[model samples]
Structures are given as structure tokens and as C-alpha cells.
Target: MKILFFDTKTYDKESFNKQLEHYPEIEIEYLKADLAPRTAPLAKGYDAVCGFVSSDVGSETMDALREAGIKLILMRCAGYNNVDLEKAEEYGIKVMRVPGYSPEAVAEHAMALALTANRRIHKAYVKVRENDFSLSGLMGFNFYEKTAGIVGTGKIGAAMAKICRGFGMKVIAYDVHRNPELDFAEYVSLDELLSRSDLISLHCPLMDSTYHLINRDTIAKMKDGVILVNTSRGGLVKTADLIEGIRARKFFGVGLDVYEEETNNVFEDRSDEILEHSTTARLLSFPNVMITSHQGFFTQEALAAISGTTLDNAVAFQKGIQNGNEVSA
Candidate 1:
């Protein structure tokens, strides 16, 4: 079967090409343009379209794809907040995603962010490069015996909790459905977790209830100078509120792998151009804030799992076999 891939980069091509050897029957065409209404017609003859987190798979795009005879929407990443699930259902387009592609990869990245931000390693590296080795601004606290609040308790969050435990930090988690397997973390109320945690890491999905979960009022609930890390969906935190919080010196440091308006700039290199997004520009002005392009799941193990599962999901759809990866509105 033929499939069209959207917003593909060099790494995506490399990983998918390597995994394509295992599935000789499938042929994939890569496109740099993201999947939006204007580009949906490009999949006219393909049986499926593969998209990344940045792709716009709204109702209009889904309608265009349906008219173009596209039957499947295969998401290479875990998050599907960008896709209009109800519209895909109406258009008879089956949606599937790689839900748990190397949870350890993302969990480890979250820890790395927290560690880097807490110890101010980025600043130290810059200072050392210039032969200014004074440790005056590099003062940092020990992770041992600190309270770590985890906002989600899925596979990724559970893995993060384990890492925090290894550092001798007390881990607490807040989730609608608690994972009994996360014995290292104690489940608590959202308010309790926010008010008590010294380090707060977000690992939740973006949904209506979770949109801007860390807003102005929620930030007010957090401990003063709390270290915050987000390796999850960008919409989970309101960028404006975060900016205000930073101005108030409410956070010790912030590490972000995703942002609410990252789709326009994340994968592309626009260093020569001026940044149009005011919030992102303001965020970059802060020395304590560290932002990375959405790359939490960019490891080799994660890419292999994503490509393998995405191909398996496509094969299942072609054979009319239902599996756990299938998503509906």
C-alpha cells in the first residue's frame, strides 16, 4: 500500500527508511509540508497519510483527504490533540498512533531538563567557555530529600517518578486515574501536589480539561521558586501566564521541550529571521528558561518503536484487524 508522510525531516526519513526494510509491501512518500487543508489534496491516490505532532489534521483537512480517497491517518507520535477525531470519524478515516514509543526516552529527557535547570548547568557551560569560572551565580540545591511533584502517572510519568526516587527525592503524583504500579509516588490532589512540590514536571496529554492546566491561578498555587519542567504537550501550559510567572520570579527555572506556538518554528531553522511570536521571544529573554524543539521522543529506540508500530497499525487497518492503537472520537 502507498502512504504519504507529512512534515518529514532528515531523522524521520532515516528512521522510517531503516524500518521500511521489515515491511516490503508498504511504500511511503515523504513531504516537507505539514498536513493542512491546502496540502491535503496531495494524498489523492494514497491509501493513508502519516503525520507528526505539528501537522494540522482539522476538519477541513480531513474533508479534503476524504475526498482524495485517504482512508487512514497514522500519527507517528503519541499526542493526537492536533487531529480532529470527530471529523475523522465522520469522514470514515481511521486514526491510529504510537502511544508508548520508548517511554524511558521521554522520561529521561524530563529528568535531564530538571537537572540542567536546577543546577544552572547551561549558565556554567557558557561561563566556563569564556574563562569566567566564578561560582557566585551557579549556586544550586541538592536533589536529595527534595519533593518532586509529577502531574501525570502514565508509563512516562511512572518512569520519571522512578528516576526521582533514584535521586532520593520524594515523588508525588496527580492524575485522574492513578497507576497502582507507581509505588514510588503517592497519588495526591492537584492542589496538594502544586502547593507542595519543590520540582514540578508535567507529563500529561493535552485535552479540553488539560488545556492550560498550568495557568495564572495554577501558577499562584505552586511553591515559590519551584523548578518546572514540561516534556509533554505544549498546550498544557499557557505561555502568557508562564511569562508573567517568570517576571514575578515565581519559578527557580523552567525547562520546556514543547511550546503552545512551536508549530511555526520548532523543526525549522529561522536563526536569520526575526521571531514573530511575542511570547516565545519574551521566553527566550529569560536566562533561567531553557526551551528545546519538541524532541523528547527523538532517540533511536523511540524512533524504531514509532516506525514499527505505525507500520503495524497500517497493516492492521489494511487487513481489517482492530488493535489497541486505533483511536476514535
Candidate 2:
């Protein structure tokens, strides 16, 4: 089977290429452009189209892909918020995703962000680079005996909770469906978690109820000087509200691997160009705020799992065997 991959990065090509050796029957063509209405026609002769989190798989793009005889939409990442599931269903295009690819990779990255920001490790690295390490303004509280609020209790969230527990922290979580396996954490209301947690980490998906979950009012509900970390979907937190919260000094530190408006900015080089988004620009000006380019799932283990699962999904679909990874509206 022939597959067309969009938004091809160097790392993506490397990982996929390494895995492609195992699937000799599958041939793939890579493109740097993102999948959208304008580029959907490029998959005219391909059996499937592989996309990432940044790809625009909306109705128009799905329509174009369907017209081009594309039967499968294989997402290489866990999040499918960018995909129009209803359109895929209407077009008879099967959508498959790597649902859980190394939850530990993302969970560890979330902890890295929280620890890095909380201890001001980045600042200390800069100071030491200039041979000036006085340790002033680098005071960080111990994670032990602190309250950690996990917003979701899925595999990733559960992993994060375990990590926090390892730090001797009290773990509290807020999720619609509580996981009984996560007995280490006590399930509580969102408001209760917000008011009680010294460190709040978001691990939820982006949905109608979760969009802008951390907004103005929600930020107000959080404890003052709380450390906030987000390694989940970008839209889960409002960038404008987060900036406002930083201005008000409501957060002791903010570590973000994703942001609401990071579509074109993330995974792209814009160092030579001026930032168009004022909120993102203002966020960079703050000392306590650290932003990464949505790289929580960039680890080797996660990439390998994603490539393997994505290929397996494609093979399963081609064989008309429903492996239960197919998604619908």
C-alpha cells in the first residue's frame, strides 16, 4: 500500500523510515507541507494519508481526501482533536490513531517541566554559563509534603500521579470517570483540586467541556503562587488567560509544552521572523514562564510505538480486520 505523509519533519522521517523496513509491502511519500484542503489533493493516488497533530484534517480536507480516493487517515500522534471525525465518517474514510504511545515519555516530560520551572533551573544554567552562580532568586520549595493536582487520570495522568507520589506529594485528581487503578490519588472536584493543589498539571483532552479549562475564572480559582504545567492538548489552556494570570503573579511558575495558538509556531523555525501573536510574545517575556514546542511525545520510545502502531493500524484496515483502533464521530 502507498501512503502519503504530511508535515514531514526530520525526526518523523527518521523514525518512520526505520520502522518502514519491517513493512516491505508499504511505500510512503513524505511532504513538508501540512495536510489541509489545499494539499489534500496530493494524496490522489495514495491508499492512505498519515498526519500528525499539526495537520488540519477538517471537513474540507476530508472531503478533498475522499474525492482523491483516500480510504484511511492515519494519525501518528495520540491527540485527534484536529481531526473532523464526523466528516471522516460521512466520507467513509477510516481514521486510526496511536492512542497510547509511551505515556511515561509524556509523563516524564511533564515532571521535567514542572521541576525545571519550579527550581528555576534554566535561569541557573544561564547564570553558571556566565560564571556567576550566587543562588539568589533561585529558592524552590520541596516537592515533598506538597499537594499535586492532576487534571486527568488516564494512563499519562496516572503515570504523572505516580511520579508526584514518588516525590512524597499528596496527589489529587479531577476526572469525569475516575480510574480505580489510581488508588494513590483521591478523586475530587475541579474547584477543590484547584484551591488545594500547590502544583497543578493538566493531562486532559480538548473537548467542549475541557476547552480553555484553565481560563480567567479557573485561574482565579487556583491557589495563589501555584505552579502550573501543561503537557496535554494546546487548547486545554487559554493563552490569553494564562498571560493575564502571569501578569497578576497568580502562578509561581508556568511550564507549557503546548499552547492554544501554537499551530504554525510549534515545530517550525521562526527565530528570524517577528512573532505575530502578542500573547505568545508576552508569555516569553516572563521569567517564570517556560514554553516548549509541544514536544512531550518526542521521545524515542514514543516515536517507535507511534510508528509501529500506525503501521499496524494501516495493515489491519487493509486486511478488513477491525482491530478496534478505528475512530468515528
Candidate 3:
């Protein structure tokens, strides 16, 4: 089976090349261009196409892929909100993804973001580099006994709950389907979690019902000086409302590894270019707010797992074996 890998970065190529030797049946041609309508045509001679989180795999791109005789889409990452699953189904394109690459990798990043944002480490790092060692604005509260709210109880969320418990924090979670093994977390309602949590970390998926879960009304419900961190889907929080919350001093510190406007800037160095009407630019202008390029699942372990599983998925599809990674609309 031949695959057209799209939106590939240096790390992607490096990791995938290491795994390619294991799967001699699968062959991949890497391309820097993202999988969009225009680039989908390049997959005409390939069996399947691989894309990252930032690839545009909507109806138009699916149309082009269908015309190109492509039948499978392999998402190396866990999240598939960027792909139009309904359109892919209509086009007879089977979509598969690595559901859980390395839960500990993402959970560790979430903990790092929460702690860094709460303690103003990002700012302190810059000040100390300039030989200005001052503790004027670096004052932060202790997390030993604080309440931590986790939005989802999946593998990653469960890992986060374990980490929070290790910090001597009270872990509370709100999920539609609760995990019985997540005994450390006290299950609660969303409103109660929002109101009671001193540190809130989002770990939920992005769906129509979960889109904009953190908005103006939800932010108003959170406690004052609460630290907000998101390492999950970007669409879960409303960016404009988050800016408003920051302006109103609702959050003590905000750390986001994902945001609504990240697609345009993901893995790209736009440092020299001036963005016009960019929400990401607005988000970056604030000192208390921090954002990463959706790299929560970027650990070496996660990358190796993703590369192995993606090729396994392609091999399974070639043999008409349903390995349960198939995603449906």
C-alpha cells in the first residue's frame, strides 16, 4: 500500500521513516504541502493519504480525494475534529486514527502548562535571562491542597487525575460517561466543577455538543483567580470570550496548547510576518496567557507510537481487517 503523507514536518518524517522499515508492505511519500483541495490531487497514484491535525480534510478535500481514487485517510494524531467524517463517509473514505498514542506524554504536558502558567514561570524565565532577578510579579499560590477539575475521564484525563493526586490536590472530574477506574477523581456536575476548581484543565474532545464548552457564561461561573489550561481540542474554548475573560481578570493565568486560530500558525514560524485580523496575535499579546503549537502529544514515545499505529492501520485496511481504529461519522 502506498500513502501520501501531508503536512509533514521534520520530526514527522524522522519518526515515520524509523517505523517504515518495520512495515515493508507500506510505502509513504512525504510532502510538505497540507492536504487541502488543491493538494489532494497529488494523491492520485497513492492508495491512502496521511494528515496531521492542521490539515483541511473537509468536504472539498474529500471530493478531490474521491476523484483521485483515494479510499482511506490515516490521522497520525488522536484528534479528528478537523476532518469532516460525514463527508468522508459519503465519499466512501474510511477514516482511522491513533486514538491514544501516549496518555502520559500529554498528561505530563498538561501538568507542566498548569504549573507554569499558575506560577508565571514563562515570564520569570525571560526576566532572569535579562539579569533582572525580581520576585515582584512571580508570587504564586501553593497547589498542595487546591482543587483541580478535569473535564474528561479518558486515558489522558485519567493520567492527569493521577498526576494531580500526586501533587496532593483534590481531583474532580465531569464527564458524560464516567470511568469506574478513575476512583481518585470525585465525579461532579460541570457547574460544580467550574465553581469549585481552583485549577481547571480541559481534556475533552471537540464535538458539536462540546464546541465552545468554555465560553462567556462558563467563564463567569468559574471562581476568581482560577488557572485555566487546555491541552485538548482547540474548539472547546471560545477564543473571543477567553480574551474577554482575561480582560476582566477572571483567570489568574491561562495556558493553552490548543486554540481556535491555531490551524494557520501550527508548526509554522510566522515571527517575521504581520498577521491581519488574527485572533492568535491578540492571544499572544497578553503576558499572563501562554500558548503552544498543539504539541501536547509530541513526546518521542507518542511519535513512535503514532508512526507504528498509522502504518498498522494502513496495513489493516489493505488486508480488509477492521482493527477497531476505524472512525465513523
Query: Which pairs of residues clash in candidate 1, taking residues 3 or more apart in a chain or in different chains?
Result: none
Clashes in predicted model 2: 0
lDDT of each: 0.92, 0.92, 0.93
Q: Write the per-residue lDDT of candidate 3 for residues 1-329, one digit (tens) a residue.
A: 99999988999999999999888888899999999999999999899999988999998999999999999999988889889999899889999999989999999999998888888899999999999998878888899999999999899999999999999999999999998888778999999999999999999999999999999999999999999999998899999999999999999999999998888888998999989999987987887888888888989999999999999999999999999999999
- For model 3, what is the C-alpha lDDT against the true structure? 0.93
- Cα lDDT of model 2 by residue, 79-142, tens digit: 8889999989888899999989999999999999999889999889989999997999788889
Total clashing residue pairs per candidate? 0, 0, 0
Candidate 1 lDDT over 193-256, as tens digits, reads 9999999999999999999999999999999989999999889999999999999999999999
TM-score of each: 0.98, 0.98, 0.98
Model 1's lDDT to the true fold? Answer: 0.92
Looking at candidate 2, what is the lDDT of residue 168? 98
